[model samples]
Target: MPSYTCSTCEREFSHCASLQNHVKVHDNAVVDRALQKISEER
Candidate 1:
């Protein structure tokens, strides 16, 4: 099993697949869009 550390959750995961799926929950497109909006607002 491969180990991965999620940057968003800061939790250690043992498998790559579970870690990938877990990361998606935090990777909302809206969040990314919001960041872009914030940057553009600056």
Candidate 2:
């Protein structure tokens, strides 16, 4: 079977839905980092 891989972390998932859900963690991390940076710049 083919695998769904996360481009950011290179993690592998067996299903597309699982890969999509996993990607949200990375997305949230990015948002968190941006917020932290903005606060630091203030």
Candidate 3:
């Protein structure tokens, strides 16, 4: 069986859709952190 692996977290998923969703979660988290940093800087 083939598995999708996350580059950022080294997690594995059984399907591409699950991997994509997982990556989006990480992307959102990074965006949230950046927004928080900007807010802190102000």
Candidate 4:
């Protein structure tokens, strides 16, 4: 079986769909941090 890996966090998943879903968590975290930074700048 092939493994899928997350580029940002280097986490591994057995299925492509699982890896894709995991990537969204990273995306959300990035957006959250951006919002926090913007709020702090004000």
Candidate 5:
């Protein structure tokens, strides 16, 4: 799994999919957006 760092929540996730679900907490829009952006690029 790849390492993903979410600055919005200051937590690291093992993968982008996990990070996407985690962003639901604290409504971390930045992290969610980052994940989406990365996904779109890929």
Candidate 6:
């Protein structure tokens, strides 16, 4: 079986779909943090 690895955190997933979803979670968190910072600076 093949495995997928996350580039940002070095986490491993057994399935590609799981890895994709996990990455999206990280991406969303990043976006949320950026939005918060912009709001604070305004």
Q: Rate the local accuracy (lDDT) of all candidates.
A: 0.85, 0.98, 0.96, 0.97, 0.81, 0.96
lDDT of 6 by residue, 1-42 (tens): 999999999999999999999999899999999999999999
- Count backbone overlaps in model 4: 0
Q: Ranking under TM-score, best-scoring first?
A: 4, 2, 3, 6, 1, 5
Q: Which stretches of candidate 5 lie over 4 Å from their true place?
A: 28-42
Each candidate's TM vs. the true structure?
A: 0.54, 0.92, 0.92, 0.95, 0.50, 0.86
Model 3, span 1-42: residue lDDT tens: 899999999999999999998999899999999999999999
Candidate 3 Cα lDDT to native: 0.96
The model with the greatest TM-score is: 4
Assess candidate 2 and give its lDDT: 0.98
Pairs with backbone N, CA or C atoms under 3 Å apart (clashes), candidate 6: none
Clashing pairs in 3: none
Candidate 5: residue pairs that collide: none
When summed lDDT is taken over every stretch of 10 residues in candidate 4, the lowest stretch is 3-12
Stretches off by above 4 angstroms in model 6 are none
Q: In model 3, which regions exceed 4 Å deviation?
A: none
Clashes of each: 0, 0, 0, 0, 0, 0
Instruction: Give the per-residue Cα lDDT of candidate 6 at 34.
Output: 100
lDDT of 6 at 5: 100
Clashes of 3: 0
Encode model 2's per-residue lDDT on 1-42: one tens digit a residue.
989999999999999999999999999999999999999999
